[model samples]
Target: MTSHNRRKVRLITALAVGTSLLGLAACSSGLTAAPSDSSAMSSPKAGGNLRVGIVGGSAKDSLDAHSPVTHPDQARVIQLYDTLVSYDNDHKVQMALADKVTPSADATTWTVHLRAGLKFSDGKPITAEDVLFTFKRITDPASPMATATSLATLKRDEMTAPDAQTAVFTFSAPFATFPDIAAQYAAGIVPTGYDPKKPVSSGPFVLESFSPGQQSVFVKNPNYWRAGQPYLDKVTIIDFPDDTARVNALLGGQVDAIDQLPLGQVNVVKANPAIKVLESSTGSWLPFTMRVDQEPFNDPKVRQAFRLIVDRKQMVDQVLGGHGTVGNDMYAPLDACYPNNVPQRNQDIAKAKSLLAEAGKSNLSVDLVTSSAAAGLVESAQVFAEQAKAAGVTVNVKKVDPGEFYGDQYLKRTFSQDFWFTRDYLPQTSNSGFANSPYNETHWDDKAWSDLVAKAQATTDEAARCDLIKAAQEIEFDRGGYIIWGFPNSVDAHSASVNGLTPDKSGIPLTSYGFRNAWLAQ
Candidate 1:
């Protein structure tokens, strides 16, 4: 046997001793409802068109299911296409279109079984060939999809559709967390002859009309795989780039609900009583990213000094309006494998100065690029600038337009701030912390960290994987480039007329933008 096969055999033998194999089977059910006090709410009655106002959209919006760059895009795509699996309010993997996904003994291969009698919006059968085609399209080099980085280890040549109901995928290494990957929003399935302009829906809604940066109208999919779902006859996602306009639309009854409710307007909307606010505690964070490959940050001491200069509690109180928990310079606070034992990092101005002095960079001054991209990003940057003065460091806060902030210089900026929703440890790291992560703003690439993640991914035992993940997290704690100050609560608002909207830990408002379950009260 090859060395990789030999290693897999040994791992299987060792894991079999006391741990069950990593074969997870999700029930063939629709999305689960988030925990809510629905005792007094009236039963859902179908037929009205639900309009939702969301922040952030531009002329660059797209209908591509594999890549959704903005809130509106994500909201629309999830309604238009279906992935094999999805996450519930607690961020647990739940089966969507697939009946069950099973892994091999060594976790190097995964077999997917589609739910029988599934059909697209056009009444075409959803076979295993469609699943294989979607994955191949995602990994195609000629046109790289957004989920390509996450599925980099997928062996394209080894993928096969054994029959109409079964599709098998082989990976280069043991991917015990393949289920989580399959649950990604960007991994939505598409038919073989898929055309972006004339999209086929495997989800609750079918696109009727789409105008980038303005609105997307979708009618209910009568053939949706889920039974008795999509209570609304239509869903209209309207993009309001300005927060004020979005909230006003909701209050003015122009829209049924709004996502990303500004912190300042939470009480204003609550006082009306005509609207109800939905709040979900999440692992989401807006972090200051320091590029480690560049000067000033290239030195480990400089990076540590920057991390030590932040007052996390103050950031949480002032910027988040006391709506979040303090962070410890790490992401994925809700991950099962999060290293809770790691000491919380508190601001130490004296130590920060000493570290800067040792790096021969005392009285350091750096421009902190920020924007009003999200609710608290610019405010946090301003707060951090004031706090850095205690360490004798000058943080020059430079505010930019939201559009320009995410433009060409987004990841290239020396020091900037960015936002992220709640994600588990491995998936979160794959997008932002790994060497080839497309959004690796810090440019942190460490072999030790990478190896630890690989081992954790291969390990089947939950406890063993947790141990490996903790070890990797410790390395990041010492030298990672992100100054994660706090995790803000996801806040959304909806008209009292709207029901079925529940809190979700995934950090996406309106139950991870789940419009399928929502219905308007007559």
Candidate 2:
């Protein structure tokens, strides 16, 4: 994997929701106004009870931060742990538990200054040994909870924590975005000796008790580096497998906060006098990611034609209920790096047919595989089928169990000519759509395209990196390896009393809800 891909992968790929209910009328931007050096609401007053609920629970796959990919697990980490660095509301990196950070002259070498007298909730000191052990374990292939693949671009080097307050990292190359990478939950600092079943973290709250398929409880961490923080003495994170149940819990006042409110329920919540719905555009993309290694998809024209048939507006309007911003050609529209003038994919039946004919293809009948569990996903599949048919393509919609789809089936079928609809971030999805480079999930390997992605991921210069990412994005857009339908603003509902909610570029916008600066409306 190139540093370019790794740069994007530094972010999480999950839709985050909170499970607590407060009286919120409209869900505005959840941003923290703390100075660059501090979180605004950090008064260090740690005590009180906060009950939150999540729409769905996490599966067993990819829970390890090193190899982790699942949303629930990512959210879990963000909720219970703290990274060395974190992002402000504007996507800028900020200090979290660390007191200060100093990067080397080459940007490849860096050091973290941990706050003094810090300790995990378990009462163990947050020592440099813990930081060293955590990184070492994550880079190790055998660490049970390791999610190392996310850091594949980096050469394995030694991490040294000379003292409890200082952690140093030496990289193989100049990584300008290293600060951003530190904000990822996968990079969250764990207990010196992390135990999977018995977990401990140097964060605001302590995992008092955990249940595999049920509720997990968090208690305030008095030793939290930030003094007098974690206002809520106890936080109950209940897992409601269904969004409705989660919503119902919120409406009935069974929970204080709720995450993952269904897209269709936006109106219901807006109409409800007692409920509050917060909405914003997410950096996440719901696209028809095609594997380029397979037959038919190997031709960029063929892929472009298929994407042309998609009625993106309809997906955002009818299927999404007009609550989201349509992703214009690129995977995400709001990211700072998107190219504005790129040609968009309009629903052109005639053009699609012509392109298909140019490819000298068959009657164009293929299976559109997707998970039925994801909200609005089934409706999206049906709509795309109708749209593609207008351009002489027949889509056989198949509802595969998400578990199977994400497993070996996705990689094998994706690279071998099978088509599927999956949710992912635009930058990471770019790699998955083509198989040019080694990690290409679609196995669509093009040397030129690979080179662009490689440059985009590794180039230390900001302007240079942006240009390369844009070029790679254009290549994918022009050729049609990804049929990005839309980049809908995600809606996450929290009680009006709940404070300090912020959204990050990463889809999991549930961080920053510590409520230390958030009072229960005295």
Candidate 3:
């Protein structure tokens, strides 16, 4: 291999390890609530037409509680469905069907008390039975919720209800982050034995109709428990298949709000007087995934070598248009558990070459697989390939249908490198996304790293957990499960007249349309 290619290989290896350990030290690990900007959330307007945008078709393919694998159609379903608990714009967990939460003295068990009077969109009193049913189906052994890991650690048989309005959970272990799991979409509620295809829920909006790949309408639920809420009477969600198309739709006044904007043009909307931007930090980063079971990647030295070559700051500046923070190779600096003093890799070509030589190989060539929808990943992949070539490694960059990119064909097939966007607290991220065998699809297993993660999670001591998490991140970055580039400040832009839009607590856009509390200014 040329000296240039060898240099890049070394960078890939070193940076991958260096960043994971120290990257998150600067990250904000504390939970942030949704922005309560007066312009976005205040008093309710009661009723109006709220038009929104969807990036792709809202996957109306199924509404069964078993479905909801994507976010496209969730806004439609959120109008009709309700989890036992919900989060207000501020990200604070609030009682939904349940009134109060009381955990047993040991904290391993939690009893949820339901609000007295509530009804599903179908007018059925949303009793505790419905909540139990919804929980059971998703947690059933026959079902493997794509998003299961978010709520997987719980023991299913441990959930019981004393009566209709109250359910109790006895855990197999004490988990400090239990409540956080309840707020995810996969835990959405449906009636017992309800067909997984047709869903029923208790929330502010109801799915009126869906036209595949076009638009879906959600009508306000008059019986919604949130009084004086769901300000708008109807929400028309238009699907914009192309990124520019969505922006164009917003500019043309055909839609009032859109969730996505190309990274370069975020400034365009900021410059426009008509739009408002809301953004927050997230535990998400562009990951260069190496299935450790495969050749070259299976060898830690090779993986670490390639990882070292990545220039995190450069990737952030070039690919994200300078709106994001440079990734340090782990999850994000926001993860409290990330270490304060782990090694950070610098782009040193000689070091990369030496590492590759140590791995008993000289020539390195591989196909870099990327998804079509991940424009950022594709652009970054090209940059990575170009940089690796300079380090004496030839990278064949290939774009594949994103639909199948994460499936068995890509996960278990011929692809060598893949891009993955990860979201969640740092510790959970380390265990599920990077750890192997039962949780990690990449199958990377390290005894010491796993032990650190376990201690961090089981303890309620925030400071200790943070320290442990930081150590685990070190292991991940140094060992070469991934090379995280950075975290970008993600925001959604909308017409200024489309007042009352803010970033949600989780760094996602506020897409649900019953924002009767939000209205267009005259």
On TM-score, the candidate that comes out on top is 1
Report the C-alpha lDDT of model 2 over 317-384, residue by residue, as the tens digit: 97778866676556545445667778776788788888889998647887877663345666778888
Ranking by TM-score: 1, 3, 2
**lDDT by residue for model 1 over 1-522, one digit each (tens)?**
000000000000011111233433232322232233232345778899999997777776777777666677778778888878776666666677886677777778888888889999999999999998999987788776766666778998789999998899999987777767677777778888899788999888999999988999999999987777788899999988788889989988999999889988988999998999999898788889999999899999999999999999999989888989999988878776788888899999999999999999998999999976677988899899999999998999998865567566867899998878877777666677777665777999999999998787778777888898889888888998888989999889999989888777877757353588788888
Scored by lDDT, the top model is 1
- Worst window of 10 by summed lDDT in candidate 1: 1-10
Structural similarity to truth (TM-score) of each candidate: 0.91, 0.82, 0.83
Q: Between 1 and 2, whose TM-score is larger?
A: 1
RMSD of 2: 7.7
* Worst window of 10 by summed lDDT in candidate 3: 1-10
What C-alpha lDDT do the candidate models reach, one value each?
Answer: 0.78, 0.58, 0.58
* lDDT (tens digit, per residue) of candidate 3 on 165-236: 887776765555555455544456676666644445576777777775578777787778766666677878
Give residue 134's error in model 1 in angstroms: 0.6
Q: Number of clashes in model 3?
A: 47
Q: How far is candidate 3 from the true structure (C-alpha RMSD, Å)?
A: 8.0
lDDT against true structure, model 1: 0.78
Better of 1 and 3 by TM-score: 1
